[model samples]
Target chain A: MMRLDNTEIRIGFFGALAVAALATLPLFSQGYYLSLGVNLMLYAALCTAWSLFSGPTHYISLATAAFFGLGTYTVGLWVDHVSFPLLVLGGGLVAAGLAALVGLATLRLSGVYFVIFTLGLAELVRQIVSWTQTKVSTRMGLYVFTDFTEVHIYWMLLALTVAVFVTGWLIGRSRLGFAMKIIGNDETVARHVGIDTARAKILLFMISGAFIGIAGAISAPRYAYIEPPSAFNPMISFLVVIMALLGGTKRLWGPLVGVIPFTILFDQVSAQFPNHTPIVMGLAFLAIVYLLPDGVTGRLEQLRARMKRPREKLGEEVRA
Target chain B: MQIIVTGILLGGTYALIALGLTLQYGVARIMNLANGETFVAACFIAFWLFTAMQINPLVGLVIIAPAAFAINWAIYSVLLKPLVDRAKNRGMLEVDSILATFGLLFLLQGLMLLAFGGSYFSYTFLAERFMILGNPFGLNRVVAFVAAVVIAVALYWFLYRTRHGTAVRAVAVDPNSAKLVAIDVAKTAAFAFALGGALTACGGALLSTFYTFNASMGVVFTMKALIIVIMGGVGDVRGAVLAALILGITETAVASLIDPGLTIAATYALFIIVLLFRPQGMFGRQTT
Candidate 1:
């Protein structure tokens, strides 16, 4: 299992601080900027869920959106009819249930097959939601209230993001993380060493689904609407995955590194060329992959490692 | 029946699309979740060139195939190659591939949306339909079908007959041994990526004629290709065509017989069924 160290502590502390800063930005910034911050935080929380299983366990499952979509619909249905906290809980529960079902069918497959299965899952949920939305009348559809300030929801979601981060950080340094790292490293060797690869993956998979589900639940009411495009998109899952990579999957804040800049760039780009955003961002991602192979946070570690190298070598010489 | 003929013809295009993916996975042992972007990107490219240059759509294949190859090559360099290089250290092949390609997928779709609006648009090309054996079928459909078979057979021959193809096979089997045998792994990988790109474009060309596709076609094509590669078993081009035929036939048959809504569900159900029963795939060899 992988173990967290001082890096995790530093990353977590800073991650929380970033969230705290985002929560207060609304006071100083306009609605659009404040809304962007909220969007970033929401994505951060969702990305955290993605980093949990995909980051540590090293599996490719696109079902993150499926869980997210379910969570959205769950809260969308509940926000008006039920209390806020319970609505959030209901979305999370629905997401978790769906995750469990998906994991049962998916964990048996490995490699690209797992990825394809998850991708299909997202499309399936999206189509279902699209069909459902079509049947309902305008006022009676699944969308929740369209007019609500996301100010309070921002902090709440921030807190949830923190909680989820801590959960993953704690688990990242625990026996389970090590077991997963081992399984991810080599299932054959780990199974030979008596690690229950299937059980560990299933548990991690469900837990991962739960976190994304909870994020979706919170986001649905905050966003004031829920539908297939917003909820079950493959791109949504892709963002979370990329965010996890940018933050350095092994470290705690990979998703944060991925989320913050990506959102800023997206917002700024959409604002600007709005026309060529796809080609520009597509090229940007290409640039990121080609140049910054380690991602943003990963690059941070590289610089740190380089700075530490000469100092350690001098220390060794002095000792000699 | 029109459905049977259409499905089989469409299957040819599907096979071509799956060809690149199968080669990438089988030879490089890299799981590319975003490979379908090549197909959709080509669709947009064809649409743009056709509108911009007024080039004949079939003649436009010359432009789309190589361009797709280049874009896919860049994708390999930008997204997949780095992750592939790090597979040894991260021991996170599956996760890394997912995240990296997930990034690629987003960037591709985002760019597509940004460059081209989300509205569905198609190019109208007139290809007179001739009765095929006294049956009604469009000339374009026949061209697409013929292209699919030729491309599939050509790829099969490339793999079995050509030196580079042999190298690709060698890389797929064992990178270390292939290196020991003097195969340039990087070159072979680049070749595989380019080949995959070209094949996907062929499918995209066919697809552009049949349906109007925007940026969103990538994931859909990726999913359908997934079913093909899985059922076909990853390494062999022949297997891919076989799998595409089965899927194309099965899907069209089901849609013809039942509801179209069942297409995705039935396909996914088949994936689970195959996965539960044969994890190595129908024709894939068991290695790890």
Candidate 2:
């Protein structure tokens, strides 16, 4: 146990270093690539947050976007009225609270039913927004200064993304993270050991929501506008999930590691084909599910595990 | 008097849709969330045959059914077979199939857009329109209703009586054991996928006559199919049929009674309520 804990510490330290280096990407990245890096950090944060609660438990919580939309709407609503930082923080808190309530009820379900309920909830939320808009005046638009380049907002999102990653890493290494992992692998065993399964799940939901919300909040400010479709769409949820799974679910820095390359690939495809963005998304998901079930981070871990084996490993170590 | 008649007309079409979901889930035990994609695919196919080839949409149902079955079988063999272990002790998380097939949904949507454009298409061959009962139901809807009933009955017979159908059922119940019994589990699953595909293609035939459709129609049908599948017990074809009727009526009634915008919400609201009370489903086995 002690040795395992130490290993987590070492890996986590490296992860922190990597995250910090990735966060400062704008300092050196070119204009087009800088935005790509910003997107990478943001989605990585969202996916990692999603993995905290749903990934481990095998719950497949589909409402990960509820908080994201909340965050988006929160920032869109508050940007004109309050400071940007406060709006972002507020988005996080609101998303966290909403997630808490949703997780408290919906997360109690398992498997397909859980996925369906969360989908219905998202649709319900979208419809509610749509319905409310019809009743109200034409002033429902998310007003903002149209000309700002969003560079500052990008930096702000990067910091929050790094902060969330660090915080998630800390929790993931803590006793609580272990408890969640235990529950994730098998709730029956976790219960036998006296881990409060419900509480652990709720904790994950809150953590995930806050991170996703922070992402949405910061992203909305960057765009200077928010809409129902963009905020609540399953596309965003699927993208984050693909990133987390692609990077390696359950790993602290998996999202950051996964999102950067994935974003670069996505940017390249979009740059080349222009209209083939969905094709890339579709192909990315297909490849991840088909060719690499464990994901990139998963592959890395297996390689690491293989390398840790004695004399045979030493002979093969030169391959890397 | 007319509500019941209208409900039955709507129910038949919905039942066919639900049957598509049931066949995949029951036989292969796979949740093909993009089953509606087949419906959309078939619609596009029928449109192509009718417009480009000068064939009537209804007349082409014969070709479309078998063709759709082949397409469905091919997709499973190509895409899904590669993903799954297809061996004993390998029933892992099936969600990957959902994601993979869902990718197909988006891919198909884009393909259809590229090929047919985003505009709605209606078969010019659809000339028959008449009333049923007091309500102004169309003749095409009646044909769809008859087709749905016949297909459901035929499926019931197939599953219960036929050798291949039994093999499919055995695979659903125990894939490994089915493999041991020389049932050719892969072929059975492929057949199940094809059967589901054929069923939706029939829906495509009905759709071309009843209503104009486009690329985006799949989402709504997918949602409605999901609700019907949930409303009906999982893997219960009969239950799915019944639940589809319940849903069709509930949706139609809610739309007529309240705001049309609230109709989708009504089904969801009902589902949320049902989930809280009966998570296994409305017709699933009673709690022990």
Candidate 3:
């Protein structure tokens, strides 16, 4: 137990050090590299936030785009009127509120129904936003001008990523996390065991929504302009799901493992063959599903177990 | 009255679209997200046939349907067979197939975009209007509607009157018991998936006769089809047809009465209400 605790502490220490090191990238790197760092941190935060709820519950929510867009639009609508930090906070709150309402109505649905409902929710929100914007203003897009540089956005995203990781870790150790694991394994059994599955799911989903919203809010200024199509793009949801799955959602840090490589690869592909980006993404998704069902971290764990098993068997033979 | 007539006519083709999705999800146990891409691919082919060879979209269906069937069969056999084989349970298969087909969606969409740039294509094939209840309606739409009805009727007859179709339905109901009764579950699933793909292609070809289409427009049809499938119940043919009309009418009403931009939002609103009130779908019996 002591050794396990010591290992946990060591991991926490090293994780902080690594993030701190990443925070210094803007000092040495400029232009494309700095922007790439920002992109990496943005996705890392989004994927981590997504996995916080979806990882444990086994309920895949594609509503990340909805919440993210709400965050983005919140910033867009109020960039001039509201302070930047206030807008970020308001964006997260708005997203969480929407999540609570949506969760109440749709969390009862299981399996594919839940998945489809969330997917529809994003599209619905986008349409409504588009319609309202059309009615309210002649211009469909809002331009956002802020004094914040790429460095500031990168730092904000990095901080958000760390916060999401820490929160996820804390949740994983809490009773709520224990309940969520039970729900994930078997919701009916969890319900039979007197767990309030709905409440648990809603709470986690709200937290996930809030984090996604904050990430969007932080990244909004970087775009300089926000339109309904780009802000509420479903590709964001797809990428987050693919990344989280690729990392293996079993561990808090798993999504980070997937996000880093995927973001980098996506950047390179889009830069080189912009028209074929979707094709590459599609292929990547198929490869990941077939070859790494358990994800990179999960595959690594299996390899470690296999390696240890042979050594343990040899030791038993020596004893015999 | 005008809205009702137009809605019903539009719904006829929508029913055909939804029917394909129902079969794919019901019998094959694969919720194919690429279903719309098949429709779009057919639309493109139909366009090509019309513009290049002066072939009618109706005649083009003869070529497109069979090719779609062959492609879907190959996809099921090569890509989805391994997934179905390895899946530990229904839920695992659902997740795996959804992810796989989601990838397939992007793949097909990307290919279509590459072949046909991001421009809307609508040929002047029977654009003449005819009177229907004192309202003018496109002749192409009426032809497409009639073709959809014929295909849907033929599908119905096959499912109800044939021995092979009985086995397919049995697999949809319960794959394990169907296997016990000597039905080849895998074979039936492959057939249903291919049939579904063919049906979707047919719908696409017919729609291409009248509807303006682009590569990315496939996802909209997909979402509309998905909404119909769920609202009608996963495997229920009659329910899908009914739900399609409901959707078509509602959308037309919303577009005519309210803002045109709110049509998608209205579809979602209805979907959410149905999901909240009756998760089993309109015609589906409650399962424990």
Candidate 4:
């Protein structure tokens, strides 16, 4: 077991405190805020789950929506026959299985090819689901009827977000995380150093898919009705990528930092100027990519290091 | 026979679009994710010109091509060049370019959405139909096919027979070696981007004459072009043409033979299979 650093301990403490505070929020808030909290938690979990693989390996998988959609469909098909928790776990396993198959086939390919393959994977899954629905069912969507309240859904999402966050933190402090970082830096060198780069990548890919799948399973019932388009929305994939990048994927808290402000901005902009929301969001993304390529957390780290330099020099001068 | 003819005709436009992508990605090593958006923007330009003025889309192509070339040149010089330079300095050019171009995709799409709302538009330029082998073919489709072939041939000639084309190829092969021969690497890159923009714009203009399209259509077109380019082996023009034909035929066959809803899925499956078996592409040099 790896020992925790001082910063890690403090972060853990504050993180637990934040989760406790958020868990109690539904008690004081009304329906609208509770729903908003649910959306926030959903996206937070997604972004964190995305960073689990793409952040470290820099592969830029565009198949998150594919796995998420698979999980939703898994629950949609079997929600009536199985227990809720069992269905959720089944959803995660299904996504993980698909990810493993895809990762095994495509992980050896580099650069744009890999990105395009992932994009195609999502589109392929969407098409298959749509086709199957048309051929097999009278309706294209499933109506989910449950007695779960708004607060109950909110708690579920919150639990998912916490689970994703802890997984991210643990991975960051693990030996696997070190290997992934090395691979991200340079795959060729990592392989030369005896890293099973492909195996590592495929493993991370499956892990990431499982978490996103669980998030999708937990969030699926909230929709009341789920269809191919809603379940496999490519926009969700893009948003997760943008949020994770904006927060600086190199750190554990990057996705959390990114999802909060961006989700609020998304809600506000869409509510006020629905037609122009894309333009607003697009411009914001452009600005972030150009000016803050390292993301908010990465930039803060730079600033902190810069500030520390003068203090270190002063200490050395006094010693001299 | 009808399906084959139709697929080949449609492949003409796909080839043109893939050619543009090959130039940007294969030759210049810049992954222009907004490639399809450029095509859509040109389509919109033609549509607006036709609707506002009595200008024919064919006539508007003259305006669209040059305008697109200039716009893309400016994008490369201003937005992408700095990022490329920095990535090169840091040795992360491939990944950085992908993200930067992805940003450009969103930027272009958003701007287009703001300018032209989510509505479908088509150029109703030649509404006549002619029968060939007992199959009714649109005059617009025939014209678009002819135009696509002519432009593709011209592009091939330029790349092979012209001095500037040779310089572009030289840079694509080895930038250091090209620079040693006094070839302006940066200028060639810019020119390639401009040419790519022009080709895709021309494709869009031709397609507008036949197909109804909206802003969101850019993403689909981009994916199709990417598939063709990957299949042809990045940067291989001849390979792109062949791959585009194959894809077009496959799509048309699937739509007619099996189910229309399965066309896109079929293409995606082909892409995955290709990546697994031959990631270097059909025409590319062996790398992986």
Badly placed stretches (over 4 Å) of model 3 are A1-4
Candidate with the larger DockQ of 3 and 4: 3
lDDT of 4 by residue, B159-219 (tens): 8999998998898788889999999999999999889999999999889988898987787
Candidate 4 residue lDDT tens string, A175-233: 78889989988888999999999888898899999998998888778888998888998
CAPRI classification of candidate 1? acceptable
DockQ of each: 0.41, 0.47, 0.73, 0.63
Given the true complex, what DockQ would model 3 score?
0.73
lDDT of 4 at A231: 92
Off by over 4 Å in 4: A1-10, A315-320, B89-91
lDDT per residue, candidate 2, A1-320, as tens digits?
Answer: 43556877897688678767766776786587777666766776777778777667755566767778888888777676788778878988988897777666555655666666665566667766766766775665575553335566567766776677667767867888899878866777998999988787887778888888888877785655567766777667777767777877756766666777777887687689755666677677788777677778788878888777876767787776
Task: State residue A241's C-alpha deviation in candidate 3, in Å.
Answer: 1.7
* Ten-residue region with minimum lDDT total, candidate 4 chain B: B88-97
Q: After superposition, how far is residue A284 of candidate 2 from its true place, in Å?
A: 1.4
| Tens digits of lDDT, candidate 2, B1-288 | 566666677878878878887778767666776777788888888878877898877678889899988888888888887666542223343667767876786777667666776788876553576676545656777777787788789988998899887887888778879888899887888889889888878876777766688875676787778778877876677778888888878877876776667766878877767666776777677755
Candidate 2 at B280: error in angstroms?
1.2
Model 1 misplaced stretches (Cα beyond 4 Å): A1-34, A78-82, A132-140, A146-148, A169-175, A184-186, A280-284, B30-34, B41-119, B126-135, B161-167, B179-186, B253-263, B285-288
C-alpha positional error of residue B4 in candidate 4 after TM-score superposition, expressed in Å: 1.0
Model 2 chain B: ten consecutive residues of lowest lDDT = B85-94
What is residue B98's positional error in candidate 1, in angstroms? 5.5
Best by DockQ: 3
Per-residue alpha-carbon lDDT of model 3 for B144-173, expressed as tens digits? 899999999999999989999899899989
Which tens-of-lDDT digit does each residue in A1-320 have in candidate 1? 65557986787688778767766776897677778878888888888878788775666566877888888888777676777788777777777777777677667556555667777888787766665556564542465774446777677778888888778867776788899888866788998999888778878887878888888777776656556667776667655655566566666667787788888877787788677655654555555555665677778889999999999999999999
